[model samples]
Target chain A: MKARGGVDWMVVVSRLVFSGVFVWAGWGKLRDPLAFADSVAAFRMLPHPVFVSLVALGVPVLEWMTAVLLWVPRWHRAARWVMTGLFALFAVALSVAQVRGLEIDCGCFGSGEPTKWSVPLAWGRAVGLLGWAIWYGWRVRGRSADQ
Target chain B: MREGLREEGLRMAVMVAGSLVLGAVVNGVRSDSVPWEYEPKAQRMSRELARVGIKEGETREVAAGAIELGEFAGMVREKSVLVIDARAPLFYRMGHVAGAINLPREGFASFLERSGLLGKDKSRAVVVYCQSETCEDSRMVAESLRRVGFTSVRVFREGWRRWLESGEPVEKPS
Candidate 1:
């Protein structure tokens, strides 16, 4: 395959790091679905029934799939988009919870007491990840003919 | 070049669709009210315990929310029930449930054992209360009791503050 615009090394590094983090988080939740449910309930975003159901099943699958797709060469670009979208969703949810003064755990890492969201941290992570995705997409578009 | 762009667009569309579908399916399955396998039976037991004002091993039963000052005075005449205040040591020292032993949340585990309270005749009713309904310290202590084979464990959800506010009998800290 042709090299894409001299290879965006920063994008590559970000993808790997984010993918690893997702994998680690997903695996921990997979080990204890009930605990994750409790964490989700603490957020108070949805009804208990709906929240419990999602955390018990949907969360782990999404996390694992996103993590796996990140490393696969064929799925790299698509995975980056999906991961970026997911993180963006998370940032939005956290922002709303903070504004509402809902002291619930982020549920990003299973069950625990509710933690305060750091706005700066959330923005930094979101921007960095989304930037990598955009860079990778731009590179691929420019080098399409060679590939 | 046009062909390459078209292919890439198609690929992106497919990937997006796949992710959305997966998310929907997972959320759909989870939104159902089915109980998960990992949630311990202790949750149900706690609910039940809260409903009835009787401890796990004790024979005497008090009305739920009967921990008011007047009620505590009337209820404790026989010394059949043990009202355990499950607040922090500092809070307990300031004042607690009248005649209630101070079982601070942190010291409860060993206190139950060392104080000979754990295996004491199950007939002695144990009423565990904490700061209030939102405080989980009492529920946790009650759950611990059940796990240790204590038959009766009642959580006084109203906790010490309610008991004090009700103007029940209270002894100042010595």
Candidate 2:
């Protein structure tokens, strides 16, 4: 397909990558709610266990929505932006956990495996995703002008 | 094209806001259904650990030089003490405190009931330990025990690693 205004191959590739990540993550959490709740508890930020459980349940829903929306051309830009914002939050949480020397799992994939927290790597990924969102926004804006 | 862009932006805003509101409402309702228990930070963990103590008939806590292996062996002979190895099952099967029952942190609830360990006398001491001091599995298992009304639960804060490191007795799986 001809690139829609500024929505070039890079944007499409970024969207696909993020969609796959979210779908895999969402499926993992959805398979085991209690495990996800335990992972959330490890963060120690949510003062209430009930709130942690709620977040555990809601996270998969959000991931699934972002994954599905990324594939739908009409919602791709919005999904990209949302996913970028969420990843930014993840980066912050992971950085704080590392700084505190917490041995808790990142819960990124909901597998309860401890992951190395690399702030630079996380920020780089966020920037790439954010770039895609901006490009898609520009493309959508250009397409609207033609209409 | 400009109009299309404006419409998409408006729709995106409305959708994002609507989803956020819906999420908040659902979470609020869910939170109302359960009791709120908080997980303390590492600093809090240290504070909590300092407050833990043992009373009579409790075999859970050990001094730095105490032999956990001997303790487990003695408990096994008594048949009164319940020893739960809170490490992952694979690790538990590889080696553990002698007579320690494997109850990996993830499946502890079911393991407790299936092992016929639950609803036992609250005063009866239960010892739970994972890999080491840094490991959170033991803490999780201890918390699970508390949730089920086990009043005499104790965590072997320095777990199997320290147990073996201290030249304490350990046994290969049968």
Candidate 3:
């Protein structure tokens, strides 16, 4: 019982950390949509300017909402999956850009000078986040079953 | 396990739909919905140009000097023009056209000193470029030069992409 309680506490802490990070990142990106779009455009993954603009606008909002949902115990299972999917996509994108030898800003937090984080480091961070989300998802599922 | 996966998938789908609607709403409410129309960086670049004594009337000349890759290459060969790469330091380090100096748009002021551009004659023909046609750092840097009293500044609108595609010689920092 003590072990189970400790596990639950760990999940809660992870949830808080994830929520805090996304909210901060989303708010920052929302403040400068054009700069964010420019960073996205640098990857050259998206072909259309309009689509890039839409992504620039959409991603922050998605992140903010998902972050909020993750904090809600009842919604944790669904939100965890969304966060995992998003982080996985980010990891893949960063890896692809690195492989292509394209130098680009991650645009994860907002727009700034040349990315301080190397491509490998950025991908690792995203993958790490995805792992946390997966763990949270499993924990939430187990909790529901216990109830 | 299968039932849980199905439930999670359905919930995720609903969340995705909700997020899309929310994003659309947030974007619509923001002033930057038009993208290019509201770049604060560009505005700052214009202001920086103004600081260097360029007036409103002279800005027309500043904006008119767009040049093609071939002409830019000619200027490089004939006039030995100073070529400025207005991209981030990392990108600049990765690769750049031969004899080009990096002076990214945001850090134009500091780079001006570091690149020894301030010591050169203002009348010397100068060319500035960035990533590609879609990128505006080249234009921004060109305007900065013009405003700083450079007598001749040309923006290579096609920028790095055209130069690379044309098989122009490139140099990476050693």
Q: Which candidate number would show the highest lDDT if scored against the true structure?
A: 3
Q: What are the candidates' individual DockQ scores?
A: 0.08, 0.23, 0.19
Off by over 4 Å in 2: A1-9, A41-54, A98-103, A115-147, B1-83, B87-110, B118-127, B131-133, B140-174
Among incorrect, acceptable, medium and high, the docking class of model 3 is incorrect
Superposed on all Cα atoms, the candidates' RMSDs to the truth, in angstroms, are: 11.3, 8.0, 10.3
What does candidate 2's lDDT look like per residue over A15-112, in tens digits?
A: 57777888888778765555566667776777666678567666776877888777776676566566767776776766666677666655667544
TM-score of chain B of each: 0.55, 0.54, 0.67
Rank list by DockQ = 2, 3, 1
Per-residue accuracy of model 2 over B1-174 as CA lDDT, tens digit each? 788668767866765566545544654565222123333333332333333331223123233322255665566567667678987777788998777888765544456667776546776778888887656667666765665667777777767877788765677956
| Number of clashes found in candidate 2 | 7
Report per-candidate TM-score of chain A alone: 0.72, 0.74, 0.86
Docking class of 2: incorrect
Residue B71 of candidate 1: its Cα lDDT?
47
State the lDDT of candidate 3 residue by residue for B27-122, as single tens digits. Answer: 778765635333346555655555544546322223578888787887776658889898878778999988888988765676776777777799
